[model samples]
Target: MISKRAQQLQPSATLKVTGRAKELKRQGKSIVSLSAGEPDFKTPQFICDAAIEAIQNGFHGYTMNTGTPELRAAIVEKLKRDNNLEFDAAQIVCSNGAKQSVGFSLLALIDKGDEVIIPAPYWVSYPEMVRLAEGESVIVRTSFENNFKLTPSQLEESITEKTKAIILCSPSNPTGSCYSKDELAALADVLRKHPNIYIISDEIYEYIVFEGDHVSILNAAPDLKDRVVLINGFSKGFAMTGWRLGYLAAHPDVVTAVSKIQSQETSAPSSISQKAAEAAYNGPLDEVLAMREEFKKRRDFMVASLNEIEGVSCFTPGGAFYVFPDISHYLGAKKPNGDTIQNSTELCLYLLDEFGLAVVPGDAFGEPDGLRMSYAAAMSDLEDAMNRFQEGLATLTVH
Candidate 1:
């Protein structure tokens, strides 16, 4: 029998689409998957080499529940260098990935019936993580016209006595929208007034920004540092998703709480992965920069192409590798077989079934009129996918 917690949980829609695409490919279908939020780039050679060195040096044993001292020190230095935030190594806890880091932070802070403010068009995992922690998700839906960013007023209005934490993702998944320094400051100003609410700033896509600097909320509101849990990882920026390394910088007590949970659960991430992540932090940034540039180009191409589709419209996202296109124009439209498409989910299914294109519907992210397509694939694959998307949409006739 499944527990209520497990029964109430919805599977990750992005991974579901990706897995289905894989299955279709295995069955000899030509599926163009824009579903996964992973960089197509290979992990840098230097990081891989560091893992090999660690293995050869007999670093296969279990590490400290928090992390290796060397890796934690490197992470502390990284925070100081990039985010302009100061943290002792004890304030950091390395986990399996940013996903786990987020979950741990939620579990550390949330209790049953506590509310976690999540902006809509959010990453699919945020609400699920809250559910796993027995917390309620308060969804604040943002608009396409405003670039899908949550405003300071919106944040202020969403806070209630039961609000325990608010999750903020820069260069966000599902929608590649990013908050500017000024925007973050405004939100921080409102946050400063709500000292009771904790901030979980997810900066996993930090280096993937196409415009301006990646400004952390800590940079904008250093006074709130004690209450902010900064979440980051090597997955996106370093093309090390498979290595499964992420970490959080928070108050020492929060770190200890998360470390306790992790000790009972995963008990420190992979020893080899931690070594590889350390190399990523200590190595050159040239490969990361190159990957960002390529993603920028893909973002541009994908946005422009999606806009050209007859009933589709997409804004140029400021960062990350996704294009959240407004596909409401096709909702209620008729298929060639006379079936009516009632929602974005139906549209996504139609696309997958008709054109073999895999994408995540916005319903999974709390927006029902849009769809998210990751541009992290090869440019040629993107080109082919876009062509198929165009061809597929042309078959729908507005009722």
Candidate 2:
């Protein structure tokens, strides 16, 4: 029998759609996929050259459970430089990816039956990671009017004695909604009252902000540094998703606990990848900035095109590559064959199977009134996708 923990988890919804779309493409279908979560750019050449130098220098052996001394120092410097957060080398732990960093942090902090508060429309993996740590997830739904951010009042109301932690993702996946400094300050005020709760700030998309500068919770609440596990990686910003490198910074005690677990589960990340990530931090941000500009163009076109479709409303996200458009108006509508699209999942599947456009359902992110479409592909692909999106919805009729 499958383990109970394995049984409790659902396969990643984004990967599911992307996988199906790839299969259709293999069968020679012209599918326009907007379901992937990674940047579409090639890994910046300088970073790749750094990895090549590492290989030539014979740095292939396993690294320390935490990370190489050099990479950890780079990450420490990055935290101070980019996020205005100070950390020592001992407080940073590198892992296979930011996803693993989050999982390890949850395992280090959460006890059985402990409740970890998560805002709705979160990255699909957050609740699953909490489950793996044998903790309960307390989901607080944020409204669209508020850009789906967790309000201070909501944070306070959700906290109980059993609450162990909360996850915050800025330039969020699935929604692309970012939390401003003022907004974070309000949430920080609420968290200040709950001294026991930990904050897991996932800043994987930190470099892709299209609005004002990206702000970390640490920037707003320096007092909470010891309790914050800041998760970041080279995946999105550096276009190094395949490199499988990410790290987290926290109190030494938390780092020690996570290192202990990682030592057994998986040792430090790849040595080559660590060297490359160090170069990424040390190198200029020119390529990252250029990618951000292109993404902003795609975001503008997508948001505008999605809104032009009757009954489809899209929020202009400040960062990240996804646009979560509200499609509730199309739910409960029927196809010409008289089949009803009852939820976001069904609507998305219909778009994929019939219209050859693949996007993820908002149900996967704890919201059923919307669906997420990635604008990370070429501008030409985005235009094709928008056309297919409109044509697909026009086929359905409401009662």
Model 1 vs. true fold: TM: 0.99
TM-score of each: 0.99, 0.99
* Cα lDDT, model 1, residue 147: 88
lDDT of each: 0.93, 0.94
Global local distance difference test of model 2? 0.94
Which regions of candidate 2 fall more than 4 Å away from where they truly are? none
Q: Least lDDT summed over 10 consecutive residues: which range in candidate 1?
A: 304-313
Which number leads on lDDT? 2
lDDT of 1 by residue, 1-399 (tens): 889999999999999988988998999999999999999999999999999999999999999999999999999998888878899999999999999999999999999999999999999999999999999999999999998999989988999999999999998888998888889999989988888899999999999999888989888888899999999999999999999999999998899899989999889899999999999999899999999999999988998899888878899898888999999999999999998999998999899978999999999999998999999999999999999998888898996
Q: Could you give the C-alpha RMSD of every candidate to the true structure, in order shown?
A: 0.8, 0.7
